[model samples]
Target: MFCYQCEQTMRSDVQDGCYTDKGVCGKTAETSDLQDILIYQVKGIAQYAQLARGLGVVDVAVDDFIQFAIFTTLTNVNFTSARFVSLVQQAAEVRNSIKDKYLAAALLKGVEAEVPMGPAQFDPAADMDNILKQESVAIVNKDHDIIGEDANGLKMLILYGMKGVCAYSHHARMLGYRQDDIDAEIERILTYLTSNPTDIEDLLNQALSAGHLNLKVMDLLDRANNETFGNQEPTQVRVTPVAGKCLLVSGHDLHDMHQILEQTKDMGINVYTHGEMLPAHAYPGLKKYPHLAGNYGGAWQDQQREFAEFPGPIVLTSNCIIEPAKNYRQRIFTTGPVGWPGVRHIEGGNYKPLIQAAKALPGFKADEEEKTITTGFGHHTVLGVADKVIDAVKSGAIKHFFMIGGCDGAKPGRNYYTELAEKTPDDTIMMTLGCNKFRFNKEEFGDIGGIPRLLDMGQCNDAFSAIKVATELANAFECGVNDLPLSLMVSWFEQKATAVLLALLAAGVKGIHLGPSLPPYLTSNLLAVLVERFDIRVNGTAEADLEKALGHAVA
Candidate 1:
């Protein structure tokens, strides 16, 4: 098995991926191979789905399956090989159904339907062993020798970015949001990928197109969240534990969080948000629940210690779930595309089993003193104070805007984000989103007159909020977004962050500082293209990068 889709992927002079028996994320080779097979099948589905759309026949179910199947392949999302096997089989069935539809629609139109070869006609092996042997079709870097490293890297950029798009689209769909144009773009890109095209310019354009597609998906998700849960408002969330039976809900699914809150309401369960779910407390509709407790832990990387130490059951609602330790494995539950081999999965929005486990365990022995952090500085809330922010900027009370946040990870260089945020001048406002904010959100940055110096914009997907805020600020200043005093210091860990990065680039936002390290899939040639065209910079030392952004050394 081979995988290099996340920041934690193996890298060295000789090897750049986890091709061994197990990955750094604890994913077994068998699981990795199965995920590859599933992805290949999804491409087959897209091949036909793209054609069927051209014939004016669209299947919402096919679109949903494509989104879900790709989301499952994201880093740390699913590690259950059995689940992938089923998904691979289901993908073939979906592909066939779509293939037939495309043919019939062309017949009705009395036009010849051009059926593509390769993945469009792929037939899954009958058994898991044979299926695993289909690595020739499933490998991510297949035909790199023919396409060369640069083209392969660009392909990976588009594929990984598409994964992020699907993940966000899946979340929006759960919230009852659907956009056919977005679906068509998804099919178009995936179908394009099947041909293994090597044209450098076309590949680069398609990669940027993925970023543009993600921008739309992010906007849809933003609307779905705001309309369904009410716009986010600035609220201080308790970080300390409360005394009672409790349940910790991690991951980024607000819909699942709401369901858990509803099912366990008034049942003596204190529901606490963890990781990306921390933003749940800022939504008026969700926070209205009396027992909707506060945040419990930092980010996803620290979950092993946090989940083990906690006395109640833990529920993972989305991606970035590592393998569960034995002690808490029985008490932990997976939902909505997240899985581990033995962990119980809660299906159909049911929480009875998870609630039962929470009741059986001992919750916090006693209430801890109140500790808080502010969140919910989404676009709506930030724009609500636009006049005050604009005035402060014009008056020279706020100098520069540093958007320093993205997916956080366990890597050593991650401390760069913390150091940069900590060292920002008092005159600069820092806006952050995703788990990377955990690196400094607990610290005090004071305020710029009436505006909080630090603005916590929701989850990773809330990059939409950050982008919206930047555009509004640019409009206020009567200049381009890049012309505004905003520097995006992105710390990426997974595909969702990749998608966000692409969105930023697609919007012509330049000079982004991206690190802990560049993706292994990025060949030096592709990196050079980004650097020359977009002025993208690999992250340097916190002091040096910060000085470059501020144009002066911090005191």
Candidate 2:
């Protein structure tokens, strides 16, 4: 149950995590232990898969499974013990399948196969109780005292960063995209973890490399989303509910949302986007459906209250799920990698039962007065109007570009982002993604040179879109991104955001402001390295940070 993987993790002298009964996110010790064990088994699969890959023998199924299995373990993704228990066995089965292929390849080459000890060559119990008992050997802090906290912290960063990569890679694979190099890196890091290496320099370098892979996965995922759903365009979505049977879909999976939208189109049920799905409204294909209503609620952390009020069924397509409140537990459905104990799971992308539940429930009583929020300012929408942005900068209409983006959490310091967004000068524009924007998105900024000052570039999963737009803007101006009038004010919450931060670090992007509290897994030594090397800063007050970001912009 010892988990410090998210921004909401407990921290104190005697308690660095939720090792007691349940985590702050409501994950039980049983489920947490099973997640750790499942990760261990996945590493075992990687141990064999990497060897087989060397012989030019690769299994797409194994690579795909690796991504999916890791996605399930990410914070707020899955809380069901049975899901993890099933995945543990599934990971072992995948490992054995890969092991046989590795051995056969070695025999053909006349090289004796050597499957290492540890996760690679281990047996698991048949049930959940025994699986939890075996967690002692598989904990991330196994040598925290002996190897020192700094080394353990670096390893955890690598592990967590790799987990983010797995989640992103899985999203890309769902849209028929997966790279062999990405697969190799996934296995490379997993195999390294089996040894628990402690060299600080090696660990740090590997972490940066993991960041690079995360960048690749994000790139792949961006293409997958655009290719599948069509490039996002500017669209104003109605914030108020329309009268009808309704299903509110949350999370980062567009593929699932598309399927659900298609299946429920003529059923007289209205589907509204929640959380990360807000940007889905801008896609031409998704917005074509008249029943695809606008966004509802705030970020993931507020779901407990928000979900209870929504008049109909809700479907979570991916991570950032809270423990279901009993009020609407039966009406809630989990799809994709998202899971909750008693919540119904819509396997194989089926939404029939969910549609039925929505029909049976009392939806919004009547259409309310229209309230609208503009979204879908993704990379394409912003880049398509590049000349206007460049001209605005040249004409001195824009002083700086602030990317106030990242995963949102319910922690106290998170208010800094809301205030920062509110305090940005009218001459500057702010871009947002993930759930963080919910803080200040409703606050109007009007437009500059016909461009909205506050741009919503899809979800936190669309960090690539933000990165791509920045790089292209820099290119258009013939300057390094650092020399451009841009400052990345990132707020991180979970492993996916961690992976995004790593990508920025790996790309040598500097002078970025990151906060809402630093990760607990980063020891002071590692934090010092990031500060010194990357010039990353902790966020202060909104006024102070805004003045600082504006002051740093290159005119």
Candidate 3:
């Protein structure tokens, strides 16, 4: 009953021993334990893939299997016991396959290590102490055991970062962007973790490599998105909730967002972006819908309360669907791998369930009778304004550009984003998406010339926007993206963020200041690799970090 897989971990020296009592993300010790086992098994699959590759065997089915295992362990994806159990069972099958093969090759060279079984495969499923004891005893290298709280903490960080990376790579493959180099790295690390736990330093190196690989994966995705959807440009998004009947869409799937907008159009129901859905307004095809209204709600973690306040049907297009309360359960629709046992699930590129639910729910009375939030300045739209942007910069009207965006959650310290945005000067332009942008949506960061300081790019997937904008800026200045006067201050909370981060790195963009906190999945060594190769850093503070980024102060 011990865990530390997030930016915030409970203190070890608490009087009540509260750290193990409650995980920083409100995860109970049991959930954390199970997640550890789940990862252990997934690593085994990676090892198996390595073995299969040496023998020349890699299949799409195996790819899908690996994707599912990684997705299950992602942040806020599966918080329930039932789903967790299902994931463990699937992992167990993969673990057993790897174990069986390893056993078969026991007499072969470099195959003497004892392969460990996943937790679900361990006997006495209800016994907790025995599970911990098994983990303690199964260490292949006594010299590198997670001997104490501190050691365990580092290992958890490395593992968690890998989980996020796996999730992103999985999504990119879904979009037809795949890289063999990344797959090789994933197999290599997974093999090492399951063959035998190694020294902290070695594992840390693997973690960094994972980040480096993620950069490649994300770059592929950025290309896939922009090539398919057209480059983003500066454009305005309507923020007013439509009058009579409204549908709030969330998550990172632009395909579904486009479908919903199409179905809801001219049907009297208004569609407003929510969560990652906020970026949909920037896509030409999607934003063309006059019914596409402004954004509603905040980050995923706040959905429990935010959904309750809304009176219309909500369509979750992807991940970060929290457990819903009874009051708003009927009005919420889930699509594309987002499932709540009772909530209506709309599948197969169809909007029938969502449209039907919207019809059944009490149509939302337009809340924006007066004020509205502006969004829709994605890369495509932004590039369209490239001339004006260049003119502004030449005229000394726009002095700085900050890519202040990433995922958001309900955590308290998340205010770092809000503060950073608030502190941005009038001469700076802030481009945003994901829930993190909500922090400054209500703030008054003055614009460059007539443009508002806060430019809302569409959802997390629309990180495609930032990538395109950077590429465009570099082109305008006749320099590489790394040489442009732009900075990426990202806050990650899930897999999509993983993909976006990778995309940023893959583009060879450097000196990204990421924060609120670093990811749980990166080992210290992995952090070093990222810092050395990509110069990525987690956020520190609004004023200090922002000033340094703006070249106004020493960081």
lDDT of 1 by residue, 85-118 (tens): 8898999999989999999999999999997888
On lDDT, the leading prediction is 1
Q: Per-prediction TM-score, please?
A: 0.99, 0.98, 0.78
Off by over 4 Å in 1: none
In model 2, residue pairs whose N, Cα or C atoms come closer than 3 Å (at least 3 residues apart or on different chains), thus clashing, are 434-459, 434-460
For residues 155-245, could you state the per-residue lDDT of candidate 3 as single tens digits? 5544555666666566566666777777777777666655344465665555556667666655666666566555555555555555677
lDDT of each: 0.92, 0.88, 0.66
For model 3, the local distance difference test gives 0.66
Instruction: Give the residue spans of candidate 3 off by over 4 A.
Output: 12-31, 93-155, 173-184, 195-204, 227-230, 259-268, 288-291, 335-353, 381-395, 442-452, 464-484, 492-514, 517-541, 550-555
Report model 2's TM-score to 2 decimal places.
Answer: 0.98
Q: Which candidate number would show the highest TM-score if scored against the true structure? A: 1
Residue lDDT tens for model 2, 1-555: 789888888999875766778999989989888888888888888888988988878999998888899999999999999988888888888988999998999999998788677889877899988878899877777779978999999888988999899998888887788898999989998899888788999998999999899989899998888888899888999989988889999988888888989999788999998988898898888899999987889888899899999999999988989989999898899988889988889888778899889989999989988989888888888889899999999999998889999988877888888888877878889898788898888888988988889998878788888889989998999988899889899998889988999999887799989887889988888889989989989888787777787774322
Window of ten residues with lowest summed lDDT in model 1: 135-144
* Residue 19, model 3: Cα distance from true site in angstroms: 5.8
Candidate 1, 484: how far from true, in Å? Answer: 0.8
